[model samples]
Target: MNPILSNLRNITLTYAIWLMIGCLLAALLVLTNISLWANALLFAVPSTLVFGSISASAYYVARSLPMKKRSFFVVAGVFGGTALIYGIIWGILCFFWNKITLLFDESWAGIEMNQHLASLLLICGTLLYLLSILVYDVLLALDNIRQAERREAASEMLARDAELQVLRTQINPHFLFNSLNSISALTTIDAAGARDMTIELAQFFRQTLALSEQQKIALSDEIALCNHFLTIEKIRFGKKLQVQMRIDPDSENCLLPPMLLQPLLENAIKHGIRDLVDGGTIELSSKVRAPWLFVAIDNPVDTQPSSAQGTGTGLKNLQARLRSLYGDKSRVEWRIAEQVFRIEITLPLERS
Candidate 1:
């Protein structure tokens, strides 16, 4: 029921827009001394009836038309058929509607259609049909262009969702392996803290499991997930891993693809901080400036740590997610200098 009403509303809106266009064309009819009110009625009558039919015809044509030769045959056939069919219907309406009114309401003489004049009317109608077909073909072309654009947009969105899903899948195993290793290390001496850490780890994995299928999320919501990730990391790293945040005032209200920031943060923790004897600081910051909002994660990296792996697995997956979301509008990159590794991201600042 809701969808039917929505479709009806859309059709009414399309007709109203098409009728206004007809009214502009009707201005020419008024210049030829058709009365203003009469021109409005007659112009809209034919244009409204014919335009509605033309739109329906063009939509189906565009849907069926092959992309390879979009400019020719199929479009021509659809509009040509529309003009011929509607011109005949319009002529019949003109003929019989008057007689019906004259007989029933006893009105004055009006234009008439009968067997004697049918052939002549069809000939004239065919010429007008070709003219109308030529005019409507322009509209059909425009409709086709808009349909192509919409399909392209939908395709991009599907690709983005697929990328996000892959990123989400990678996160669980990486974090799980790390947490299990931490638990393995802690179980011998500090059994109680290890047990507590297991609880926190459970909570973190619970959140991750819940979020596995989500593609997009509110900025605040993604932050909450990040906080959970940090909570589990905190249980293991304790006072050594210092996490700081300086989020922009505007960005907390924005919507973003889910799990986008966590992978970068995890990489920072794994490679930059935890590998060192004495862990370092991780800072998250964001600020919006007109075209984009910049979010940055910075941590001091130890070059001579026990593990010296450079950029590894999650880095490429993170890049794919950013590529899918921002396409041309977003960026994520890493830089290292003076023992500090910084991950910077710029995203569209939008609200849900």
Candidate 2:
């Protein structure tokens, strides 16, 4: 639906309510003996229609006079100009209408066709027209609020997608550099292993390319990608790099941002296992608790910490991605205690 049409449809009930108020005012005039029922109906119905049509000008006025730039003079001018125009138009309409009704009923002609009655009708019509403008102003305010919220939502979505892309791109160069360096080291010692690793690297990149196009994927698919990454690393480390998985069956189908966990696993391998003489164990686990999915990666680190410290770029990138995707609903935490380095991530569990 067109936005303007949709908004008008939503406010139909408000228009109906105001129309009822106009009818009630007409009844009051008849009951109070101020005017006959026929005269009141004729006056009130056309007055209400004119008020409605004139008030529609408020939408255009509102567009011209933005809230940020609105001033007392501007507002006064708009309302005063509107009321003046409405009074002239309404006065002419009431005059002709009264003249026509007087032709039909000579008694009403004498009673209603007077300067005092004309002035009173003109004043009432102007007031009611101003009231209609007020109603329109309120409607304009509400429409502005709705439009602002929509624009904000669109901007947030765009920012999130941009941040996700940046984080994903960051992963490729860093991981490729490490993988190429590993392949360089293995080529002389074990040609067959390097060849296998190269083939695995090609396949892993192909899968990464496919997954990158999606915003979210099943946990099982992510784990499969991680396993492929570990397979390539295992070629270089052999039995030295041991991995254990304790993923809950129920959490497997939960949806998360694509490549979310891969960087954490890479961090564990580079910081915890790569430095050790007898490469330590990497434990991967996942489980769901109602609306939340919990994933943890743990690896044994050297008793004597390395003199070279990690820059923590991967962890920082992952944290940024989590915040962009879920705002405050998701988080990543890391702790190192007793030669065990652990990274835990909590994500909102969404599934199709």
lDDT of each: 0.67, 0.80
lDDT of 1 by residue, 1-352 (tens): 1111248786676667656755654564356443354533453345445644443443443345555666666657765676567557655654554454446432232323356445544444445555544444455667669988999999988877776766776776777887788888889877887898899888766776665566666677777888887877787788889989998777887767777788778888888887767888899888878767788899988877654675567778776776777777787788998999988877877777
TM-score of each: 0.64, 0.88
Quick one: RMSD of model 2?
3.0
User: What is candidate 2's lDDT per residue for 1-352, written digit by digit as tens?
Assistant: 2223357664585467557756875797777677876667766665565555555555565556677888999888987677767776777776776677667765543235567666766777667667766666777788889999999999989988888888888987888999998899999999999999999999999988888898889999999999999999999989889999999999999999888877778878888898899898999999999899999999999888688778988888888888888889998888889899889999998974
The lDDT of model 2 is 0.80
TM-score of 1: 0.64
Q: Give me the overall lDDT of model 1.
A: 0.67
Off by over 4 Å in 2: 1-34, 50-58, 61-70, 106-111
